[model samples]
Target: MNEPWNPYDVMPAARSADPAAAGARIDALPVSERWKRRFRLIAKAGGPRLPNLGALTFGERMAVMFSVLGLLFGPLYLLCKGLWRPALAYSLIIVAVGFAALMLGLEMLARGVGYGAAVLCANRACALYYRQRVLGERPWL
Candidate 1:
């Protein structure tokens, strides 16, 4: 049996020799064009960038997806992802918002705000996780 060809085996040399191909490969990634551009910008800013969305491991992709959907499990998800600081911050914010809403007799508004905050926290967590794990960059959030 023949071994399958590995793209990485030739990537470093090919990328150096044919910049256009590298650009084409980046453009062909499964993510949106905007994200592709952002990836390039991130690379230029001295951060790591994946060659394509397919380059992400299954675990990494799942983590990001779960984080984005982490309204009910925001703190738990972040904690499991080893983002203790963010988890604590998000928990504190939710508690404070809940308390304020109760004191103001605006339970509905508080619930809405809490939901929004959860979504925002999840999004930020996803970005932070991607930067730290996939891009090999330090966490900033």
Candidate 2:
């Protein structure tokens, strides 16, 4: 494995007999490319494993940090990506944030926080969903 890292690398694709699962896997597959970089950053921050972020080139660093589709659309984007479970969870989070916004009199702040949380959670949520549906592994985040 001496080859340098490529952001467009195809992840290990898992095939399933179920058509629905197959479709979901299709959506979840691309996430690995993006999330692989993001997860490396997350892992480097004293998580389960700490990898060397300094090794990433400038382009790779940009890939790990910048994404707004998830932030702009939030859970709706998750649903479009065949991640219903995460969408549901994010919806509940929005509801809770709405309640807090009402009580705290900071509607914009609460909504902003909720949307930001979705961006942070989106990749890992996709990783977990892909593992569970495609690999038949228990999905835990």
Candidate 3:
């Protein structure tokens, strides 16, 4: 039996189906290629269940990285990015940690807790910001 010669049959599936090809496709995006590569690496680190980094822009990825590394300035960064809710939430977490540490008479522990909370908040904020910007989803926090 002869098969029909449908043009659709010859075309490749969406660019995202193959991981290697997906990287190349992402490189072609208008944003900085270096940032795209870094975002790809970050997404890959999250394992198979996570979506690739094509949805985020270079600026967005940088924002996430900066927020994660610069804990003290993270809230300011978020605020400048128009992420007021996240900034407020992070600030409140710092305040709560401070209060708890004061009640426990452990001032040094408060610093550690604040730093830890900042790291955690930065990660969640990255995901939340990505969802909001790329998927048009509301902030989970």
Candidate 4:
């Protein structure tokens, strides 16, 4: 052979249809460019930043958000039922099903708005966390 093999010289386009080609393209990109691409993908998925809730791997964000929403509604449900054990049990079920229904409804209502709200909320949460953790600012409510 007239030339030595060079993996870097064999890089492919980022939009290549083949997985191997795409991997090669990413491997050839600079770290900052790679992160930029990652953030773009997250933004496309309705995240405000690279690591927003929408940017979390698939079902993880869903589980976390659903759990929080369920917790928020739990006390109201218990009050509405007025019985201790049954109220707790039914409240749990309602939270589960209600979360599912609400997700579906939001999808049907306007996916853009729903996802935008999720992204905005995630951004605000991230900002608050950073302020509290790094700046030693305590939140009062």
Tens digit of lDDT per residue, candidate 3, span 16-131?
A: 33445545544553445543554455444341224544555777545445454435566665665445677788778878888989899998998887777767666665554433
Model 2: per-residue Cα lDDT over 5-101, one tens digit each? 3323454544433434444444444445555445444333322221344666666544444445665676776566555666777688778877888
Number of clashes found in candidate 2: 0
- Error at 74, model 2, angstroms: 1.1
Question: Model 4 off-target regions past 4 Å?
Answer: 1-110, 139-141
lDDT, each prediction: 0.54, 0.52, 0.53, 0.37
Ten-residue region with minimum lDDT total, candidate 2: 42-51
Cα lDDT tens digits for candidate 1, 1-141:
135523223222212212343355545545565445544443333333334445555764444333544566767777775566667787888789889998999989888877777776665665554354334333435
For candidate 1, what is the lDDT? Answer: 0.54
Better of 1 and 4 by lDDT: 1
Point out the worst 10-residue segment of candidate 4 by lDDT.
126-135
lDDT of 4 by residue, 1-141 (tens): 236423224223223123233344434433355333543333333432234455466654443233232244443332332223333444465456556757788544354443433443333332222222222233221
The TM-score measured for candidate 4 stands at 0.21
